[model samples]
Target: MANPADGTVCNGKLHNHQKQSNGSQSGNHKRNGIIRETQQNGKPYFYNKPFVESFEKVPMYLAIFTNLSYGIGTLFGYLRDFLRKHGIEKCNMAVERKEQNDFVPLYQDFENFYTRNIYMRIRDSWNRPICSVPGPTFDVMERVSDDYNWTFKFTGRIIQDVINVGSYNYLGFAEKSDESLTTVRNVLMKYGAGVCSSRQEMGHIDKHEELENLVAQFLGVEAAMVFGMGFATNSMNIPALVGKGCLILSDELNHASIVLGARLSKATIRTFKHNNMKNLEKLLREAVIYGQPRSRRAWKKILILVEGIFSMEGSIVRLPEIIALKKKYKAYLYMDEAHSIGSLGPRGQGVVDYFGLDPCDVDVLMGTFTKSFGAAGGYIAGRKDLVDYLRVHSYGAVYATSMSAPIAEQIIRSMKCLMGLDGTTNGMQRVRQLAQNTRYFRSRLNEMGFIIYGNQDSPVVPLLLCLPSKVAAFARILLKRKIGVVVVGFPATPLVAARARFCMSSSHTREMLDTVLKEVDEIGNNLSVKYSRHKKSACPELLDETSFELED
Candidate 1:
C-alpha cells in the first residue's frame, strides 16, 4: 500500500505536502505542478476529500439471527414483566415506595422497560473503568456482577497493559509522562487544583487570560473564552448566541450537548440529514424565504450546527460544502470540533485547516481540550465582539467557574506543541504518524471484510457488529484477550446499526495495530461479522481509491 503519511489520493495521484509555516495566510500555492492550493490557504497541506459510501449490506443469515435474538429477548421480557405484575414472580429491581405511590415516576415507561430488559444484558460492554492514563494501553479495574450488570463490585483484579482502542486520546497526549504533564504539574503547584469561584467573581486567573490568548492565536480567531466543562461549552454558549425568535438548523445526528443547548435556547429547531449538503441548502433556503411558523415573520437569525468529526459514525463533515451553503444562505455557522482539533489537518488545526478554509468563515469555532490535548475544559473562539458578548451573557462564563489552572496549562502546552511553537517537530510527527496509523488500520479492517463506517481519513473507526448480542460478545471477548474497546447499540445508535468503535491515536504503533487485527480477524470469523461481499481485500489497490482534494 502507498504510505498514508505521503498524503491521500487526489485526482488519481498521491499528494504529499510540506508543513504549515507560522507566517502563512490563506491563499493559492503550487507544488510539483499539482494545484495543491485552497481558495483560503496559500500554504500547501494535505486534504482528505469527502466521499459517499453506503454501509455494507447485512448478510441474510446474520440478519435473521440478529432479529431472532431480539425477538426472543423481547418476548421473554414482556412475559417476565407480566408475571411480576401479577405477583407470580418478584422484580428485584422494583422500588417499593408506598408513600410515593401518588407521585409520578421520574422515568419514562418505555425507557425504564428498555433499561431493565434490553440494555442491562449488554451494559457490561460500556463504561468500563480504567485506573491508569487513557493512552494506547491502560489498566482497567476488573469488576464482578451478581445481578447480570444491574450492580457490580470490584474484583480487585487490575488488567494491566490492556490495549485501549476505546478512548479519544487522538494525539497521544493523554499520558502520565510528557512535557504537557510537566507544565500541568508546575501550574498545579503554583495555582492549586481549581478556582473556587466563577470567572465573573474571583475565578478569572492569569492562566485563563494566557490560555484564551493562546487559544485565539491557535485557532486564528480574534478572541476566545474558556469554560470549565466541555459539554457546557456547547450547551451554554449556543443559547447565549441565539434565543426564542432565532432558528437552529442542526444536523440530525448532532451530539447530545448540541441538542440540549438548542432546546435550552428555546429556538425553533429543524434537523437535516447528516452531512447532506443538498438537504442543508434546502433548509437554509426555506428558512430564509418562508420565515417562522404561524407568524410568518422573518426569524431573528439562523445558526447551522455541525461537528468536525461525528463521534459515533466516524464521519467527517462536508465542510467546504457547508461553508459555501452558509455563505449562500447568509446564515451563521457553529462547528463543534470536539473530536477533530489536534487530530486532523497537516497542522492539527481541525477541519477548517484540513480544508484550508479560513477560520473566520466559521462564525463560531468551539472545541474541548479533553480529547486531543488530554485535558479538561472547552473554548469558543470567534470575532472579538462575539466572544465579548458571550463573556457577559454566556452562563458558562458568568456563572460557571473558570477552567482549572492545571487544565489551562495543559491546553496551553499541548496547543503550543500542536502548532509547533514548542520549537520541536514532535507535534507534526505525531500528526503524520496518526494519519499513517489511521489509514493503515482502516485498510486492514476493510481487507478483513469487517464492514466499517465513516470517511477513510477519520480516526474513529466503527466496525459493524450488527446485533446487540454480538456487540457485547465482541467487547467482552476483546477485553478477555487484553484489548479494550467500546461497543454501542440501541439508544446511542439505531438498534440495527450496533457497532464497536475503535478510536485511533498517535500512540498506537504498527505492531499494536497488527495484534488487534489478528485477534479481531479470528473473533470476526467466529462471530460471522465479516458480512462484506466486496472483492477489494483480495485486490488491495482498490482501498486507496478514496478521494482527496483542494477546493479552489
Candidate 2:
C-alpha cells in the first residue's frame, strides 16, 4: 500500500514518481497527470460505482406517503414565502433587524423559511423543559404557544410523574441516588465546584490523575487522558491524531462530533454505507490500490472511524470485521463508545467487550462519561505514548478547563461500582438489568408489528414513523399519556425516517416498560404507525421494499 512514487512526497518522505509514458497525452491524462495507467480492480473512480442501499426494506407505501408529505409541505412553504415577499402576508419568525438589514442577514432565507413554515408547527414536541431529575420518571413543565409556536408562555402547570424514555440515563447513574452522591459531595467540599483553569495550567489535581488511572484500568489500556467536554473530546483530539494528507474512512451515519472532527483534521474523507462491511472493504481496497487522488502519493495515514453503538440507528458496530479490515489494510481504527460503555457486554466494558475482542486492537479508544457514567466530560485511552502525545498536542487538554473535581469523583465512584470494586454487585446488576430491559422492550415492540431499528440488545431504540406529522403526533400523544419522549425528523434523519427514540435504563422497572408498551399500542393504532407485519432484516439482499401493511 505504501508503494513509493517517482519524485513525490508521501508521509513526509520523498519518493520517486512513475516515469511518464512516451504515448501522446489525452485530455483525461493531461488533467489527471498520469501516464498509461492500468486498473487494479476496475477504474480508480470507485465512488462512481453504483450506490447500494444498506437497508432497502422501507415499505413502498411508506416511501410514497413520506415523499408526498414533504412535496406538499414544500409547495405550501414556497407559496407562503412568495406571498410574504409580496407583502400579502407577514413573516412572524426570524424578522431581520432594521439596523442589521445593512449588514449580512443573521440567517439565510432557507433556514428562516424552514423554521417558520415547517419546524415551528411541531416545536412543542422538542426541548420541553423538565422540572425534576431525568431518571425513570420526571416532571415536564407545561407550556402553550400563543401564535402557532411563534411565541410561548408557561401555563404555570407541571406534568407530574412523566415516564422518561428520552434521556440517556443508561445505567441510571444520573438519578440523584445515595450510591455515589456522598463521594461527589465529599469531593465538592474538598475541591470546590470549578477547576477554573486548563489541565496544562493549574487545573491538574489528584482526582484527575486518579480518574485517568481508573479509566485506564477499566478499559485495560496502558494509559488514559480526560477532557472537560464530551463533544470536544472527539472534535479536538481527532485533529491531533491525523491531518492534511491522511485519509478518513467514516461511517455515513456517524455522529456529528465525529463528522466535525474529521472535517477539522483536513483529512480526505470518504464515507462508507452505514454498517455495510462490503462497501467499506471496497473503499479500503480502492484506497490502497489508488493511493492519494491524482498525485497517487501514499496517504500519511488511513483511519477507519466507527461508533461502538450508533445513537441514531441504534445499531452496534461490527467490531470484529472492522478490526480485521483495519489489520488487513494496515490502517488505524478509532471507536467512539459513547452509548455502548456501561450498557453492553458481560462486563459493560463496551463493544469491545460485547464482541469479546481485544481492546488493544483499537488504536484510539474514545468515549464520554455523560451517558452511562452519569457524569460530565469524556476520555481517550490507549497506549501510554498516545495518551502522552495527546497531553501535549490535544487542544482540549491544552486549552479547555479541566474536569470538575466532583465530576471526576462521580466517574471514579460509578466506575468502581460498575467494576464491583465498591464491594458490591450493584454495578453488574445494573448492567444485567439494562440488558434484560433492552431485550424485553425490543422484542415487545417487534411483536407488536412496529418497524424498529437497531440491534436487539441495544438500549437506544428507534421506532420508525415515516411522516413529519406522525413524529409530532407521536410525541404529543405520548406526552398526554404522561410519558416524555424524544422524536426526530428531517435533518437529523432521512426525511422518510422520522422516529421516536427510546433510551432504556436500569432504573426503569417492568411496570414502567409495560405502561409505555400499552400506551404505544393505543397510539400506534390511532396513528396507524404499526404498518409492518414482519421484522425486516437490515441486510441489503434480504430487504423487501414492496412489503407493507394496511390497517384493517
Candidate 3:
C-alpha cells in the first residue's frame, strides 16, 4: 500500500499526486491507480460484452448461447415462488463440511447449525428483494400461510401491498412525481444515461460542477467534491486523507464503511464509546500523550470519526460537545452526514446546520444524496484545499465512474428547493413535515408502551425488540398486517439489542402515522414486548448502550 499523504508508493516511486499550499491552490494535479485487470473468461464468460474484460478462451457463439441460457434461467425464477410459499427452503450458509477428523466441528458445521436453527426460520423475510419503487407504501411478495409452526404460520398469499417504514427515502423524492423530478428528466434527455468514465478520466460534466457548488453552499463549506456512490465516498476517501503514522479515534458504533476505511489506511485506531464525550476525551488524551499503540512514538495526525446520525441507533451526534473536544484535543473531525443531510435541520444542510455550528469547525465533512435528496451519490465538502486534494488523490475519484449527469441535476434541483431559491417552498415544507412526522411517531410509540431508541428529532425511530426471535416475529406479524418494517438481529446489532427500525418520511400522512402506531401498539402488546408499569425489564432499555460499550 502507498502512503498517500506524502505522495509515495512502497517502492519509493514518486506518484503524480502533489500537495498544494493553501494560499496557492490554483495548481492542477493528475491521479492514477491500478486494479487487478485481466478477468478470467468462462466460456470466454457467459456474457461477452464490449465493456467487461474476460481472460478465459471460448467461441463467441457459445458465449452468446450461455448468456441467453443464463437469462432464460433467471426468467424462470418466478417458478420457485410456487414451491417456496409452501415448504421451508433450506439455507446455503457459508461454512465448511465436517469431513476431516481434525477439522473443528463447530467451525465446519456452522453453516448447518445456522441453516437449521436460524436461517431456515427467517430467511424468507430477511432478503426479499423488491421489484417496485420503495416509498411510504410498496408492493412485496406476500407469503401464503400453508401451515402452523412453533414461531408463526405460513400464509395463503404470494404477494401483497404494505405500508413502508423500512426505507431511507425520507422525503419520498425517489418515488416523487413532482415538478422537481422534471429537472432530472430534462437533464436525462441532454446527457443520456451515465458519464461512462471516471471524473478523473474526462467524464466530468457541467452539472457536476453546479451540484458541488450547491452542496458547498448548503453546508457552508469552501468547496465540495462529488462521487458516484455514497458508500465508497467514505471507504475510499479516508485512505487518501490518513495513513500509517496517523491515529484515528472512531465511534464504536460508526458505519461499517468507516471501519473498513480505517483498517485500509493502516492507522493506529482507538475506539470511543458511541456518542460518549467523556470516553472520547479520555481516548484523545491518551492519543496525545502515548501516541501510536505499539510504537509509542509521536503521532503524525489525529482524526476523530463519527456519524451525523447513527443509522442503527437513530441517535444524533453530540456535535457541540464533540466540536469543543476536537478543538481542545487538536484533532481533525470527520463527520459522515449520510443520514442527516437533506433530512435533519430546518434548512436541511445536515447536523452542523441542525446544531447551528460553524462548518469550518469540522475538518472533513462527508454526506450522501441518496437519503433526502432522492438521488444517487455522496460528497466530501470542506476547505477548498481539502476538496482539491481529494479530487486528485482519492481512490474513488481515480477509478469510479463520475456521478450520472441527471442524478447530479436531481440533487441540484432538490438543494435549490430546500433553499427556497427555485420559486417554491416545497423544499422547506418537506423538511418541516419530516420533522413533524418523526416527532409524532416517536411520541406515539412512547405513549403506546413501546421501548424506542434514538433522539426525539430523528426520522429513524428504532423499537428495541430485546429477543432475536422477537425481531423475526415483529417483522413477520407486521408484514402480514400490510406493514413493511425493517428488522436486524445478531451480527448487525448486538444479539440482545435486535430491533425493528421505522424510518419516517415527509410524505407520510397523519393518517399513515396513526395506522402504524395503532397496529404497532397492538402487535407489541400481543407479543408481550411492550413496557408497561407491571412489566418493565429488570435491566431497563433506557440504559444507554454507550455506558457498557466495549471500545476497540
Best by lDDT: 1
- TM-score-best of 1 and 3: 1
Provide C-alpha RMSD values for all models, in order: 5.6, 13.2, 18.2
Q: Model 2, poorest ten-residue lDDT window?
A: 6-15
Residue 171's lDDT in candidate 1: 95
Model 1 sits at a Cα RMSD from the real structure of: 5.6
- State which candidate, 1 or 2, has the greater TM-score: 1
Q: Give lDDT tens digits, candidate 3, residues 1-552.
A: 323322111222211111122322223222111111111222111111111110112234533554564355335433433344344543233434447556655544423443434545565554565556787787775443232221334344445457888889897777756564787888899999989999888898899888888787777767899999999998999999999899999999999999999989998898998777789999889888998768899789999999998999888887767887887788899999999998876567687656544577789999998888888899999999999999899999989999999889988887888877899878878887787787667766766666666666678887867555566788888887878888876567764566788999988888988898888989988887764332322223323433222111
lDDT of 1 by residue, 1-552 (tens): 122322122223212122223334444544222233453343334553324333455667877877788788889999988897787976667664778767896545555776788888788876768899999999999988987887899989899999989899999988888544887898899999979999999999999999998888877778899999999999999999999889999999999999999999999999999887778889899988889998889989999999999999888887767877887788999999999998888778898777666677789999999999998989999899999999899999888878889888888888888877899988888887788788777878888888777767789999989888789999999999999999988778876778999999999998999999999999999998887776344325435534222122
Error of 1 at 15 (Å): 18
Write one digit per residue (lDDT tens) for candidate 2, span 350-378.
88666545577899999999999988999
Ordered from best to worst TM-score, the candidate numbers read 1, 2, 3
Higher-scoring candidate on TM-score, 2 or 3: 2
Q: Candidate 2 at residue 503, lDDT?
A: 98
Point to the candidate with the largest TM-score.
1
* lDDT values, one for every candidate: 0.81, 0.81, 0.71
TM-score of 3: 0.75
The TM-score values for the models, in the order shown, are 0.90, 0.86, 0.75
